[model samples]
Target: MTIHSRAKVHRMFELVEPIATVTFSDVPNEAFLAIGMRNYWDGYFAGRAAPLGMVPAEVVHAVFYNFADGEVARHIPWVWGKTTPAEAIAVRERGSALALRQLIGELADSAELAQVADLATRAGLSAPTEGRVLYAGLQALDVPEEPVAKLWHAATPLREHRGDGHNAALVANGIGGTEAHVLMALAAGMPAEKFGRIHHLPKAQLDGVVDGLRRRGLVDAAGGFTDTGRATKSRIESLTDELAAPPYDVLTPDELDQLIAGLEPIAAAVEAADH
Candidate 1:
C-alpha cells in the first residue's frame, strides 16, 4: 500500500503550498533528523503505509538520507555524510573514508558544531525506517514552550478541534506504534538539539526531519507562520485529533494537546485573514 494515501499525501504539498516550492533543499542532518523521523514514521506506519519491498533496503534509505542531508551538512564529513553525493566537475569531494566520529571530535570546541556532529552520528547509526529509532531519541528533549506550542490547541479557537482530532488519529492509530512517538515530538515543537537530548538521540536526526519539512515547504524558520504553515499546522492538528478519537484512538491527551498548542494560533490567523 502507499505509505501516504493520496488524501494524506496532499497535506505536504497542499496545506504547505505557500511555502511549498519545486526545489526547496532538505535540511542539514542537524535540522532534518528532528522532522524527518516523524514523516518517516507517519508514512510508514500510517493507514497508507508504503512498506519496503524486496529491493535493496539501502536504496530506499539512501533516498531518505540523501534527500534530508543537504549541502550544508556535507561539510561535516565530505567523504561520507554529505560529500560523497557531491559531484565535483569530478568525484573529488569524496575525500576520505574517515569515521564520522573523527570529524565530529575535531569540532568538539564548537557547541553548535558538536551538537550538529551528534545529530549526524545518530542519523548515520539509525535504521532505514525513515530513521525512526533515532528520531524517537531526538524528540525526547525538553525545550521552552513557544507561543503556538500545540497543533491541536491552535484549532480550538476556530472550533476546528474535530479536524485536529483527525490528524492525531492518523499519527497515533492510523499509523503504527514506533512512528507515533516521532510525530508526537514534531507536534510538540521540539527543535533539533533539545529534541535529540530528550529522546537520547543525536540532534542531527531531528535536523533531518525538520529539513525534510522545510524542503517540502511545509515549514519555515522565518520568525512567524506563513499562511500555508498555519493551514498545514491546523490540518495536522485536526488530523491528529481525528486519529486520536475513540474507537481507534492512537494518541494520548498530552500528544493531542501538543498538536493543538502548536496549531491554534495559526488557525486563528487563517480565520482572521479570511474575514
Candidate 2:
C-alpha cells in the first residue's frame, strides 16, 4: 500500500475500535455483573479471552502484552471459574449491542450501520491469522446475528490484529510491557501517575521502567523523549501502521471511504456517551 493508503487503513480501523472497546465501560459492566463476574477486570479479561477457550493466565499475558506483571493472572483462571467463556462471550455481545443502541439511538439499527458492519467484517476476516493470537481467537467465533452486536464483533478482530502488530513492534524494539506504558505516557504527554494507574503499575515499578528507559538513552532526565527515543517511537508506530494495512486491502478506495464515513458518526456518538 502507498503511504496514503496505509494511513487511510489505520484511520478506518481506529474509527471502528471504539465499537468493541466501549464494552469496557459501565454500560456493559452491568451485564457482566449480572453474569456472575466479580468486577470490571473479570468481565474485561473473561470477555476478551473467551474465544481462546479456558486458557491460563500466562497465555493471556503473552497475547495481551502490556498489562502489569501478574495482572492477567489476578483475573484469568479465577474469572473462568465464576463464568464460562461461552457465557462471557454471550453477555459481552448482548451488552455491547445494548450500549450501541443507547449511544447511537436509531442509528444502531439503520441500513447504513449494517453496511459498515459488512464492510468491516470483510476487512477483518481478510487479515492473515499467522502470529495474530487475539485476532485468530476472535476470528474463530461465528458472527453475531444482531445488527449492533455484529458491528462490535467485526471491530474486535481488526482491533486485535492491529494490537498484535503493535506488540510485535514493541518486542522488536526491546520494549517490555511496563516500559511500553511509560513510553506511551511520555510520548502522549499523559501524566505519569494517571497512565501508571491505568496500567496498574506501582509507583516504584513505574519509576524503575522510566529509569531503565533513561539508561538506554530513550528518555531524558526530565522524563521526556530523547531524540533517539522520539525516532524509535516513530519507527514503532510506522511499522504498526504498515502491519495493520493488509486487512484494508480487501476494500476498494471507495468502499474504504464509505466505511470510514459510516463509522465516524457512530464513533463520535460512542465517545459522547462515554463522557
lDDT per residue as tens, model 2, 180-269: 877788788985657754546667887788889999999998988999998999999889988898788788888888999999999988
lDDT of each: 0.30, 0.85
Best by TM-score: 2
TM-score against native, each model: 0.24, 0.95
Give the residue spans of candidate 2 off by over 4 A.
1-4, 196-200
Q: Candidate 1, which segments miss by more than 4 Å at Cα?
A: 1-190, 196-199, 222-226, 246-275
Among these predictions, the greatest lDDT belongs to 2
Cα shift from native, residue 174, model 2 (Å): 0.8
How accurate locally is residue 270 in candidate 2, as Cα lDDT from 0 to 100?
86
Give lDDT tens digits, candidate 1, residues 1-275: 22233343233222222111101112212222332323322222111011122223343333232123232222222222222221210111011111111222333244443332232233222222222422222223222122111111111111222222343444543332222334444556654344432354445665565555556554577423446545665665555433322211232344333433432333333334334
